[model samples]
Target chain A: MSDRATLSTVAARAGVSPSTASLAFAGSPRVAPATVERVLRAAGELGYAGPDPIAASLRRGRSGVVGAVIGERLLYAFRDPVAVQMLDGLTEVLGELGVGLLLLAGDGGPAPAQLGRLPLDAAVFATCGLEDDPAFRLLRARRVPLVAVEGPVVAGVPLVDIEDRQGTVELAAHLRELGHRRVAMVTMPLRLDGRRGPVDADRLATGVYRDTRERLLGAREVFADLPAVETASNGIEEGEQAGAALLSGPDRPTAILAQSDLLAAGVLRAAAARGLAVPGDLSVAGFDGADLPWLAPVRLTTVVQPTAEKGRAAGRAVVALLAGEVPPDVVFPVVLRPGTTTGPAPA
Target chain B: MSDRATLSTVAARAGVSPSTASLAFAGSPRVAPATVERVLRAAGELGYAGPDPIAASLRRGRSGVVGAVIGERLLYAFRDPVAVQMLDGLTEVLGELGVGLLLLAGDGGPAPAQLGRLPLDAAVFATCGLEDDPAFRLLRARRVPLVAVEGPVVAGVPLVDIEDRQGTVELAAHLRELGHRRVAMVTMPLRLDGRRGPVDADRLATGVYRDTRERLLGAREVFADLPAVETASNGIEEGEQAGAALLSGPDRPTAILAQSDLLAAGVLRAAAARGLAVPGDLSVAGFDGADLPWLAPVRLTTVVQPTAEKGRAAGRAVVALLAGEVPPDVVFPVVLRPGTTTGPAPA
Candidate 1:
């Protein structure tokens, strides 16, 4: 490591200053074409890979990398098409900004230490819960510009919020309009403890995840005292388990409102397993207008949020923060998409 | 920026040496508890964020970040459950190694400049086509430790390969045993140029992607002169389009071997559209035994690759490379999962 060639060595060989060598390597117009050619020859001779990025970043005070703190495990996060679409939109803008996206596991995984050690010009809390977030504390301590997509509201950190509460309200209202009174909810994790079961009053009050609580509250607004079952994660299998738990009761609900499309798909499976018709016996609705091509012909009644645009908004906020400007909070609207899965209540 | 607090400023305020302040911030046992307290108090007073990670990384000659070069757009890459599973596995091991995974878009998508500027200890080529990869050349020039999952073989760069050719060979043989003589193929992108439709002899000969070519060759070995339709990307929609094209042709084949389960799902959709009964009028097979909960009661006959294990192997290889060891290339075996989608050819 000590013997590794530095820019100075290349500069000496090229008969130029270290700054001139750097300019030549950067392809800056200040350096003459002949100087750039001479530097390249010298660099090729010494096997120099140009300026060391770490050292260059130290001098520039920017890493050209933005960290996205994924709240769940990488597999679970990637499995959600909503997260993927948001990240895709984010990368599209970040690419134009010339910064790379670095994924850090946020839910008390390896993020705290990584946050302290890794270089990030800014960070976006993609899926982490808002309450008592350890990564948030560490980033704030480091004074790293922070932005969150659909997470908690902090004073300094600009948030890219969707109509989580409003979307579910509209979805519940739609089910209500269809003359379904017996309705139950399949909710995402109310807490980060990986608890999967019925959401008791105590758990509901102590819920740390903002999106889960807000969505649940939205549905409760339409159907107060709505019996809700919680999932360990926002996945299809979790939804299936929760769905089964809800349906097995002596008094099964006529309609089920899942927090996400994946969870709704699982509920649909549970409905299928029990030999019940989709809209004839049970009406199902979900959030997130995620593309479910396999569920073709049976379109889901979901709240279609602007997932990609939300990502792009977060990306733009990060850009604004990096430019030493404070970006305001952005809230996107959601619409109700009525599909084949939701219909009038059974006779 | 110039007025920002530095360690020296805090150290001076605490009446301590800069090195002592550094050790105190790192929570070194050598520093007395009272001295650590004094340093923290001074840091808080002056709004110092402890040690600068950029300067610290420069001193250690490590960035604590590993780059994963995704070959496709972030949305497309995340949409594939196989890619997600693989990345999940990679992140599991990487998290244990205390390193963060940075995503760099490959295939001439803001990667070359990123490769030059971002600090990465090593990189893994997750889904990029092997031939003439600009990211590969750039990383090689930077002398970054490289590991590839199912890509072209490069000297000194350890590869975590699957039984791609062999797995397809067995799958093709199974279809052959079913008395299917007229078999068509729906393949992943044979090239990175986003061309969709029939694969001509020229395109087949010039195909750069190893996995696509090997899988196609395996099927061709079982059924010589097997016609194949190429997809722009690996997705259900792409599969549906390709499936429609294959099914609309005058010479309809008795069986279709899709390169992926997503594509196979699309093929199933096309068959349903035409009122063709699966395994009765036409048998369909696919690669990658992905979990498709939406395609209930209809399991796909495909090859199941240990996607997560492949990712873990790549992670371990990166660890070994960082330890100055040349890890041997690992090739994992694949299994043929016989599902409900495939049976004896029609009549």
Candidate 2:
């Protein structure tokens, strides 16, 4: 009564063994109802509600938590609908597995001081550009199972990625079929230290984000001289900024291809501001066929990637690794969905 | 290395005490750099990377994770931009405090089995209608610090709420000032068992969700015979559905006020579908002045609640409680933001 009460103290007061008390707390079917009631009564009297989760986890060798490293400030990362949808799928699977999702600040990579203290059964690098994160190395050293969703396919780490190049190629093909000759592109950041500006060939060469580079390359395959304006982040505002910069010139491109739906929506806004009717004066298309309810009545021509499925696959891989099975890296396919946004180039 | 290596084995091999080895793994500054290096070398040889976080948490009496109980299905919950913004603010504060956020599924209440397994220093009831949740009771029994936002306020749990009634009253007053004689309202679910239909006075009387009830009352004060349509959920699609149901009648109200911004956006879409110009044919207003980038150019007249600030306040309350301080409950104010959506009620 003098010291902080524990399961042992409750067990001692209940005239039961420590294991019996633990079983009672765990709701083991073997324990008699009478014995469980006695344990509960004793626990109530000693203010010992149950066993400490920390201690229980230590004994079980599992923390019942999956650490999801989200890159960049949540304020920005969460704004992208693709990220939110993927997280939704991931949480759905993890919750079914009776594991809580622990959101860790990756900020493009992991923070060691933060990651070192938290208990995790598995660590998932959800953010891109995590090829050489020291924190990931630390997690590896700690023997934690790793699941990389959108980054470099490291050996032994279960990787989940989409066909970025193929998806972009399909998008470019859609534009080309629509007779879009002078096509401009609004791209996601090429560097971790990204900014909004015209991306030159040299900047593209030094790109760390594999998806960005792959998408750029795929577009270039269609249009040899594809002019692209890279945004600081994958957001509508930045997309709009890119659109304004590209369309302000007298020789505005007949069509604009944005990497994400959010950026594509921005391009739409820019077109509207310039009094250029969509598909009439210019054509616009986007990647990630995200269901943007707000952009209703303006269905975008986009490459639909299985974002939620990608997340679920990552989660299943984590489950497999935890079960001592080596799951193969998964690469999902992306397809083009031609919406009302893209049409034949203007006369 | 014949058996699975542990901290003790590494300590023995390094010629250091077990505590010293642990200190080295924890990166304690007190330990000499050379001694730490020796410990690391010994650990590498024995395949002991570091101390188990579970064991360290047990010894430290802290889990270093805050559990945020999000109600309803994650698919539906994450779709709500308001909830995501609040979570963004909550994470920003918790992350700054070196505490990882553990997202727990509340599903309208709490999943006792799931809550029981999570090791939490604090539990935040971010969802609504949790006055009598078994999961909350379990958390209380475990003596975890409690923080509630927008629900039945318990005696001890720190509560964070917005000026729901006051804000609604202000919105209604704005509609009245706009020379609107007949004003209809679209509300969020009144009860946990919500449906999409016209809500009469009896239904309003038996409503459980306090925010919904309060907002309805505020509107009634302005338009005594204010008819309201209750939606199954607070979504733009639902709002659109509600708008269709409300507007496809002979007695159509000139102005409609929706409880959330998403619902209001639906109303806007409904008007567009019916070939009614917003603010010209029907004036529409929404609540929770959310940053709807897609709803650009047509700025919705809404009551802007400081959602992020509310989340931050809840987080600060959690921090205070963890620091053994009883922080006061917070009641954040909401302000009316006049956009292009509101004008003098249709001629």
Measured by lDDT, the strongest candidate is 1
Model 1: per-residue Cα lDDT over B1-347, one tens digit each: 55889999999999999999999988899999999999999999999977888899999988988999898888888788888888888888888877889998753235586677889899999876476688888888898889988876888889999888999999999999999998999999987788999998899899888999999999999999999999999998888899889989998998999999989999999998999999888899899888777787898999999988998998999999999999999999999999998889887
| Model 2: DockQ vs. true structure | 0.49
Which stretches of candidate 2 lie above 4 Å from their native place? A1-4, A32-34, A44-47, A107-111, B1-5, B24-49, B107-110
Measured by TM-score, the strongest candidate is: 1
lDDT to native, each model: 0.89, 0.85
Give per-residue CA lDDT, model 2, range B185-254, as digits (tens). Answer: 9999887575779898788877767788888888888788799999988888999999988899788888
lDDT digits (tens) for residues A1-347 of candidate 1: 54779999999999999999999988899989999999999999999987899999999999888998888888888788999888888888998877889898753235476668888899999876567688888898888999988776888889999988999899999999999999999999987688999888999999888999999999999999898999999889899899999999988999999999999999999999998999999999999999877777889999999999999999999999999999999999999999988989897
lDDT, residue B18, candidate 1: 98
Report candidate 1's fraction of native contacts: 0.61
Q: How close is chain A of candidate 2 to the true chain A, as a TM-score? A: 0.94
* Model 1 alpha-carbon drift over 4 Å, by segment: A107-111, B1-3, B25-49, B107-111
- Distance (Å) between predicted and true CA of A126, model 1? 0.4
TM-score of each: 0.95, 0.94
Which lDDT value does model 2 have at B193? 74
